[model samples]
Target: MISTSKHITVFEHQAIKLNQEIDGVLFDETRLKALQSYYGENGVPYYSLIHNGVRFNEYVGVIQVGETIIEVLPKADNSLKGSNEKKRWRDILIDMLFAVGIFDIHSPSNSSLKLKSNSILDLYFELFIKEVEYLLHNGLVKQYRKKEGNVTALKGNILFGKHIQQNITHQERFYSRYSTYDVEHNLHSILFKTIKLLKQINTNVELHSRIGALLLHFPEMPEIKVSESTFEKLVFNRKTQSYKKAIDISKLLLLKYHPDVSKGRNNVLALMFDMNKLWEQFVFISIRRHKEKQITITAQTSKYFWKPESGYRSKIRPDIVVNKDKADCVVLDTKWKNLNGYNPSPDDLRQMYVYHEYYNAKRVALIYPGTNTSKSSGIYLDPITSKEIDKECSVISLSVEPKIREWQKNIYETFNNWLTFGNDNVQKNKNASL
Candidate 1:
C-alpha cells in the first residue's frame, strides 16, 4: 500500500499545481519538472499532495494533509456561524459549479443529494452517481458507430482481404453499437471507469463501498479507458446531452486520473482545467444566463487586434463581448485578482483601450472578484485622458461568494446597468415590453 503518510509540498501557480505523473495520479519529483516546465515557478514548491488523482488546477482552494486522508478547503469562506470544514468545501464546490457554467444545472426544486465534508470525492461521486442514476431512470438510449473485427459472423461490413483464408477469417464489423447513448462514451464511460478505480483508492471504506454500489447501478455502461485527446473527439446530441449532464462533476474525476493497465490496479488518470479560464467562462455564462434576451453574449470571439506589420494578426482576445442586434456593443474582460481599493492595473486598462478601438465598442468593462473587505464598484473611463477615443471604460467587481441569495439578480442588475446606454437592443426591447 502507498504510504498514507507521504506528503509532497508545493505551490499553486496561477491556481495550478503540476502533477509529476500525467496518468499515475501521484506526487513526486516529476511534479517539480512539470511545475517548472508549465508554470516556470523557480521557488520551492508549496503545494501538498494528499492522494492519488490528477493534481487539480483547483479553485482558490487548499489541500490539507491529514493523518489518514487529505482535505480540500476553499479560500472563499462564509460569515455563517458554526461553519465547519465540510460546509466550506460544500460552499466552494457550489461556487465552482456556478463558475463552471452549471449554476442552473439542477433546478432549486429538484436538488436531492446532500453534501458531505469527509472526502471531496464524495461530492463528485454523489453528483456522478446521482446523474448516472438519472440517466438510468431516464430510459433513453442513443446509437453510435462501434467498429470491431471478428471471424464469428458478418455484422456491419466485410473488408475483403487476400490474407484471409477459409480457416482464418478476419471480418471487420463496421456496425452501429446500439448501446445506450450514455453508455461507454468518452464522458460517461470514463466516469464509470474512474469510479471503479476510486473504490480502490478511497480511504473511506463506506464511501468507496457506496461507490462500488453505484458502479453496479451502471450495469450496461462499460468502463472505458480513454485519453483526454481521444474522448474529446466524440459528439453528443440533444438526447445524449441530458444523459451525461453530470459530465461536469464526472470531469473532475476524469481529469484527476486515468486507468493504466501497465500499473494494473494503480490505474489512475487526471487532467487540469485552468481556474482562470474556467472563471472567465463562468463569469460570461452567469452574465449571459441573466441578460435580456435581446442582448447576446459573445464569448472569446476569434477576432483579434491586428497591426500593419508584416500582415500578421496579434492574438489579443477579450474575455466577453456583448452584441446588440449582431453588432459588437460592449467589450469586457474578467480579472481573477482582488484589486483591494486600487485602480485597475495600467496594463489591463491599456488592453481594454485597444479592444475598444479595435472593436469600436462604445463601452468597455473590466470585472474582478468581489470580496467583502475590498470594493471597486466601477470607474468610468475619464473623457479627459481617453486619447480622443469613441468608447468609455469601466472596472466592475462581481461577488465571488456562493451564499449570496440574489446573486443572479445581482448579476442582472450589474450587467444591465453597464450596457443600458450602449445596447440599442435592450433599449428597443425594454420600452416594448415594460
Candidate 2:
C-alpha cells in the first residue's frame, strides 16, 4: 500500500549490500589496511569527501595487512568537538554513497559498529552507508520522493491503515508500546515520539525509574486505604501482616466472614499486589521533592514488630506512614489492580476495607490506572457503614499513556498538591487552640 515493495528493495539493495561489505571488511584484515593508508600519515585526516574537508573528531585507528589498508572510525562524541551538528562526517559520507548506489549498509544491533566488505572504497563507503541505513530504517531520514496523485492518495490510505495496526499492537503490548514498530515504520520512531512527549511534561517525574518500575509492575490493582486508628492500634500493638499473611487473611475473611468474597487466582494476584506495592513505594520515593517528606515516604521511623491478633501473629508494616508537622499521621496501603468493575470481586474490596478498619485514616484512596470503560468507577465503601461509600475514599488512577517527561511532572504535581493540601488542612485546626 505504501510502496512496501519499493521500500524493501531500496533497503535490501542498498543497506543490505553495504552491511554485507562492512561485515566482510571487519572480518578481513587486508582490505582494512588499504583503507588505513587512505587516511594519510597523521592517523587522522580531513575528508572533503564526507563533510567538506571537516576534521573527524573521533578516530578508531588504522591497520595495514599485506596489500590492504583498513581505516577504523570510532563512535563520534559531539561534546569533544564542541559542535551542535547532528550528522557526523562519517554519516554524511555514507549517506552520499548510499544515494549514489556505491554500496548498501545496515546498522548493527545495540548501536555497535557498521559493517562493510567488497573493495576498499566500498568498505570506506560502507561506514556512511550503514548510518544512512540506520536513518532510513529508523524513519529518521525522510526524503521527499515525487509520486503520482493517485499513488499519493493510496500512500496516505496505506499510512492510515498502518497507524491503526500500530495502535492495536500497542494495546496488546502495554508495557512495551514505546519500543514497537509497524511493518511500514521503524521502532526508532516510536522511541523518538515517546521522548518528544516526555519533554512536554513536568520535570519532577523520575522518567526512567518510574516507567521502568511501572512496566515491572503492570496489571496493577487499585490503591487501598487503611484507617488512622487501625494503623495506630496495629502500630501500638506491634502486630501486623506481610503480603503472605494478608493473602491468607483475605481468603479466610472472604470465605468465612463474607461468603460473597470469591476466591480468584490468589497466587498470581498476590505476586502482582506485592510487586505493585514495592513499585509504588519506589516511585513515590523517587519523585518526592521535599526532603522532610522522606521519613513518611520511606516508613523508616517505626520499627518492625509482630503481635498475635486476628489469627495471625504477623509484623504489620504499613507501606507508608509518617508524622510530620502534626501529631496525626498519614497512612497508605498499596493495592495492585483495577479499582472498579461491575460485580467487583469481594477479595479486593475486603482488602481495602480491612486497611481502612485497621488504620484510622481521615482519608483513604484506591488508586488505579484509568481505563476507557471504567474511568469514574472505583470501590469507595465506608468503613463505618459497611456499605458502598459515596466519596469518603477516593479512587484515583495514574495515566499509563503519559510521555515519560509528563509523567514525571504529574508525579511532582501530585506530591506538591498532597503536601500543600495536608499542610493547609492541618493549619485550619490547630492543637494549640484546642
Candidate 3:
C-alpha cells in the first residue's frame, strides 16, 4: 500500500489501515476483507484482525492476496526509517532462512538474482522451479503403483467380478489390477500440483518461461489432492533421496496455499515462518556447523520432568544442548526478541532454572538476537540463606551481522568463549566470574 503498485512492506506486529491513507502502507478494504475471510476459515496465526486493518504477528514472510503482495519482514531493533531499512531486514530474513537450511542456494542459477528485487514468495517460487528443472534434466524416478482399468492383456491380478461385469461384451478385454513402474506416483503428483500452483499464483515474469518449460518437459502426472498427511507419509531411499529438497519446498508451498473458491479474486499463497522457530534453528545449526569436533550439539532433546498422579508426564526440551567430551553439558534457550533494557520474563528464567536442575548442566544461558554482542551473568539465590548459589545462567547476545557467515562465526566463538569459563579449575574454586 506504499504505492498503488500492489506491493507493500510491513514489519512484524505492524498494521496498515484499510481504505485510508496511513503513514506506512495503505491496505485496501476489499483485500483486507479477503484476507479476513481466509483467516476466519484457515485460523492461521500469521495475522490477526484489527480495527480497520490486519496486524501481522511474529511470522515473517510474503503474503499474496490476489495480485497484491504484503511482505512481512523481521525486526530486531527500533530502526524503521524507509525503504532502505526494509530492504536490509528483508535481506537479513532471507539470509537467516538460507543459513538455517529452510531453502537451498548451494547451486544457484540465474533465478537467484531475482532474490534481491522480488518478495520472499517469488524467491521460493523460483527455488521450486529450479529444483523441478534439475529433476527434469536428471530424469524423474519411477515407482510401482497399482493401476485398475480395462487392459488388453493379463497382468499382476485380475478383477474377475469387474471383468465379467464390464468386459463381458468385449471378449478380448479384461478388467485387471496391475502394478506398473512409472512416473505417475505421489512424488510426481506433488511436484506436478506445485507446478500448476506456481502457474496460477506466480506473478514474476522472469520465472514464467522456466515454469512453462517444466510443464512441457516434466512427465505428465495424474492430478491428486495433497494434504499435510500426504507429505508426512512420504518415504525416500537413495534413489528418491535427490527429490528431498524439491519435495520439501513443494510441501511448504502446497500446504500453505489456499485457493479462493467463493470469490476467486483473493487466492492466498502464504510462505510465512514463525520467527521464534527460525531463530532457534539458526542458532542450533550455526553452532553445530562451526563448533569443535569434540563438541556435540543436540536440539529439542526432551526429558520427562514432571509426572502427574494418573496422566502423562511433562517433558522439558531445551533449544540447544552442547556437550563436550561427554563430561560437560550446556543448555541454551534461543529467543527471537531483542532484550534491550528489559529482563527476561520470570517464566523464561524459571524454565531455564528447571533445565539446569533436570539436565545437571554446567551452564545455561538464554540466547537472543541483538545488535550489540555482550554477555551478562546471573546466579540463582538460596531461598532461605538469601545468598548466591553455584548454579549460573547468562543472557548472551550474538550480534546480528549483515553477513551470515560472519554472524555464524561470532556465534561459534561467543559460545565457545562462554563455555571456556566453566573449564577453569581455579575459577571453579572461587565464585563464578563474569
Shift in Å, residue 179, candidate 1? 13
Model 3, C-alpha of 113: deviation from truth (Å): 5.2
lDDT by residue for model 2 over 1-434, one digit each (tens)? 12211101011001122112332232223222232334436643222122212232222222222222223332212232312121232333233233333333343331243232222222332233234234433443222323222221123223345445554555332211122122222122222222222232212222334334323322222233323332233321122111122222223222221111223211100001122433355335534533343444444223324565666565445555534333344454444444444433565445445544455444444444333212122435445865654223333445432233454456445544553463233333332211
Question: What C-alpha root-mean-square deviation, in Å, does candidate 1 show against the real structure?
Answer: 9.3
Q: How accurate is candidate 3 locally (lDDT)?
A: 0.83
Q: How many residue-pair clashes does candidate 1 contain?
A: 16
TM-score of 1: 0.62
Which is better, 2 or 3, measured by TM-score?
3
Query: Please, what are the lDDT tens digits per residue for candidate 1 over residues 1-434?
Result: 34444333222332323344221235544434333333224522333233332333344333322212223343332344334534654565556554565533443332454554434444555666666666667763646546444435445554445225432532343322222333445555655666665666555444655667777776545546555664567567876677445665655555554333433333332222345665687677667777777787788875665667678776878888888334557888987665766777778878888887677776787877655522122333446663322344566776655553466567657777656643334333322211
Q: What residue runs in model 2 are displaced by over 4 Å at the alpha carbon?
A: 1-278, 287-295, 299-312, 322-328, 338-345, 357-359, 371-391, 415-434
lDDT of 3 by residue, 1-434 (tens): 35546778889998877775543446678888888988886577999988878889999999999988888999998655788788889888988888887777435544345656578988888778877777887888889988899988878788999999998789898899999988889999899989988988888778888889888888788889889889889999999888998999999888878889988989988888999999999999988988888888999999997899998999988999888225488899999998886778888988999988888888899999887887777677777986778887788887788888898989988888888864334344335432
Error of 3 at 410 (Å): 0.7
Candidate 2 or 1, higher TM-score: 1
> Which candidate has the top score in lDDT?
3
For model 1, give the 10-residue run with minimal summed lDDT: 61-70
Backbone clash count for every predicted candidate, in the order shown: 16, 50, 0
Better-scoring candidate (lDDT), 1 or 2: 1
Q: After superposition, how far is residue 370 of candidate 1 from its true place, in Å?
A: 2.7
